[model samples]
Target chain A: MRFPRWLLSDRTGLVLLAVLMIIGIGVPALNLLVPPDHPLHLTAYTVTLLGKYLCYALLAVSIDLVWGYMGILSLGHAAFFTLGGYCFGMYMMRQIGTRGVYGDPVLPDFMVFLNWKDLPWYWHSFDMFWFAALMVMVVPGLLAFIFGWFAFRSRVSGVYLSIITQALTYALMLAFFRNEMGFGGNNGLTDFKDILGYSIHADETRIVLFVLSALALAGGYLACRWLVSTRMGRVLVAIRDSEDRTRFLGYRVEQVKTLVFTFSAMLAGVAGALYVPQVGIINPGEFAPLNSIEAVIWVAVGGRGTLVGAVVGAVLVNYSKSWLTAALPEVWLFALGGLFVAVTLLLPYGLIGLLRRRRETAS
Target chain B: MSELIFEPEAAGMHTPVAPVDATHGILLYLEGVTVSFDGFKAIDNLSLYIGDGELRCIIGPNGAGKTTMMDIITGKTKPDAGRVFFGQTIDLLKLDEPAIARIGIGRKFQKPTVIEPLTVLENLELAMSGAKRLRGLMTTRMSGEERDRISAVLDQVGLNEQAQRLAGVLAHGQKQWLEIGMLLMQEPRLLLVDEPVAGMTPAEMERTAELLKSLAGNHSVVVVEHDMGFVRSIADQVTVLHQGRVLAEGRLDELQVDPLVIEVYLGGEDAHH
Candidate 1:
């Protein structure tokens, strides 16, 4: 079992993987094995919160793939995230069959509430778990493909491309808020009960979800790490540095960008799917442009172009967010803004870059 | 035979074979190509033909449409009127920049444009012919022969020791050579080099002259240079461009003596030398 040089060479990635493995095993053991009264026992609430952070970390990695490597600063990645969430949420809605207040077997409570007698055409196959799982990736991947096809082909890049991406998530947020769109209106999808016949509220189920999120993050990181090691990865950096130079070298720059963009969107989709179950809800609020921008901030704060940095940034910032919002509430947004400004002015390469520079200088 | 059996090119090759039909002697044909920005004509009725394996030096004053000529040939700028063709069959106007490059034309910019963050070897690898598509680029590993080819290019460009170093740390002359090394990796039939000896030391300029001279006959090198002495050293034939069209086409010595070339280009001052 020979591991490739890329995996072994990445010191940060090795540390990240080791830390995840410990948490993956340790969290489940503490939650399931220990009695509630024991000091070592981890509550189910803590597990779910950790699970949510892992999902956010996965989303951050997806943003880093395109934004850092491919030089596509996508401020609309949450559109893909929310779309994946909605896909999974539809399945959960179907699972509620006759258990709702309306007690309708075929129609979801929202459809009945809206006076819709039948399930919409798009929502038909979502009742099956397999179909819903596949749609989670497909919907976001396809949207990214179509959008990137037009955008990259037209050579809309730099700040202009960033602006349109922000516009994309903002537009999705507005559209999903409408009840007419069939995605449960302003409140979005909620009241999820079972996932694959296991009670989502069960402690064991929450533990499984936590472990799965950890696994997904590890897998996504390895996949991205492997990608950047390939010759295509060099082409990505080349495109990022000088797109015209890459073009003159006979590489199809637009196609490369589109394919990578689509792949990144799929990764974001997977993160969102995991997120909905852990959080027990999916709403139009998930599509807010602010969510996408916050994801970018995580990558910038951690270090852009470094995969390990994305995960570390996401977890650290989100943990701080959890604490700050609880402790001071109103000052959380200001702190985030201040942190972003400070990082921009003081640490252009972010925290990881600063550490690497210090280590190099000391040695 | 056993060694040959393991060769990647032998087992379904990926390198693009040059499709340029230069048997008729002329490799590139630009006829009556005219492009304008605002009301002023940048390139007006410009007709130029580059011969097979010919080392042609193009000299002009500022805004003489020298860069614009290279632009039209490379598909960076579409001429508002006229025909641009590679060989006798392939219409260059129909293809885009990457498409033109794939067919066998390579262009170097006025400034050195290497991927600075990448190593010298990686920069050459990116410009190597073949595997431009998604599937090939994603999966194909560099073969042993490909590594040898890169090594040969590194030696040719005098950057073998710097192969592992980031291109960003390279000196100006070294960066220029690296850019040329990238062009050579494509194995292009026609190379459009823009201001190759600009901002180079005397020794570096001489070495560049030697390198460009070595590239001729194997590759049709069209060098657009401003330095007259460098041009005289390397150019067999000189094309003086003035106001978007050819002013004179002859040897450097003859062009130096010609009245029209002296009046429009040499300013009648440098012509005496």
Candidate 2:
């Protein structure tokens, strides 16, 4: 089949594909083929870092889809990501089976330690990988659907909507922190062993996980590209500019907002799921509202409305974050805080907007 | 054939089955419509009607409820109590803003409201007859016919040469015309235009008067305006509103002679000073 013009003609899409190809193939090759002593060898630490960035990129893109294009700034997206991680983490815990320190075939160690009698009914289908995978998308998507149905229907928007989202993530963080919630509390779920029968710590497994994360990020970007290019995307842009005007034009503002909002949550959930397997743990701390706010900063720093900007911002910001925490840890938060204020006051369109202007002048 | 604005014949774009509601003499009917915000009645027991294909100019002083009246007809505002009907069958009071638009009622805002980031042509395509639904839009392709429709509207609005330009970059008058052209893309049965000449130059106002007048027979046009000169230039029938109720209804020449309409305008001016 001939290549679709949208994928080929779009400079941003092409850039995304090139970047994904290098990471998807190149990193895995380095990890598997290079000798440990070789300075060029891709360290497991680096692979895991890149893999985590891909997950964050997916989350940032999802946030941009709503916040930038649809004008729905969701500061609670971390809740969905945490929910997804917990969903997959539950499966990870279940996979321990007889190998768990307690040697219990069915009950996870937390339940046995807590002296719970039998497995919770909610945990019934979580043992299967496919079920857990489905939950990773469904749990977040469902929560967003219900939340958006009420919020959008009532016409809550702007900073009030943003505040509500922050409240939601904070509340979830508190809920997940409770010991009786069945989900591992405080310390949360960890000590994961096998995943689909492969040792979780195996180098080959890590490489595969890294590869899958890159692929997920690529797929997420493409799906978003297709959505934003369509007529529905035009409706989103219209709603963003003048919501009441779009409504009077016969577009149901609530339905449009709901669709995009729910879809974004699911994408963030998938991102979170990938993140957990690569990072090797899931905890209530992931649900903190601050994490979602940081994700928003990434999108803002990259460029809000530009899809490629979101991906670039996510990867770049996290890379900075990792380096900063190790280098000048005392100044990381202040630097990030200052970056958001600077972007808001100066760049407005983020880094991508600056790049576009430079290219225009050059051309 | 509203969908004819696109490649209906060539691109095989899905043709929308426009629900044609038979009118019984009146194209739009409103009776005893009332709306209040914080006990201040914006529209107070308003009753109005437009005959089929009628060009009715609604003139009133500020706070005249002209905009609120249009809002009721277009389902943007729900009256505390009233009857609003499109043609004979559709009860507008029961429907939402989008459902009313789907039934072929289109409205232009007081301020020019065009989708800014989108190109002028894209703004028209979005409001074009087809691709209104999410499913249709998802699988839709821009057909040759759709291009012609956009070109036609662009020419009509005198923006044919600027079709590729972003709507946000258009001059103020051009943005108003772009919005009108966007409305025209709907091929609406009834058009509610609010203050179309608000920000236009005198020459632009004249062109807008001509443009609005030409649209009367094909679509029932209800234009709310404060420009008496522009109203006199195009109105076939005039409805004067005062304090959310009908002050007078007649030809512009006839209403100019009415004591109540004169008193309301004189009173409005007195308060301004």
The per-model lDDT (C-alpha) reads 0.90, 0.86
Q: Estimate each model's TM-score.
A: 0.96, 0.95
Candidate 1, residue A325: CA error in Å? 0.5
- Interface Cα RMSD of candidate 1: 7.5
Clashing pairs in 1: none
Best by DockQ: 1
For residues A207-323, could you state the per-residue lDDT of candidate 1 as single tens digits?
999999999999999999889988989989999999999989987787778878988999999999999999999999999989999999999999999988899889999999999
lDDT of 2 at A256: 73
True contacts kept of each: 0.66, 0.60
User: What does TM-score give for chain A of every model?
Assistant: 0.99, 0.98
Off by over 4 Å in 1: B1-18, B268-273
User: How does candidate 1 fare on TM-score?
Assistant: 0.96
lDDT of candidate 2 at residue B145, scale 0 to 100: 88
What tier of docking accuracy does candidate 2 attain? Answer: acceptable
Model 1 chain B: which ten-residue window has the lowest total lDDT?
B4-13
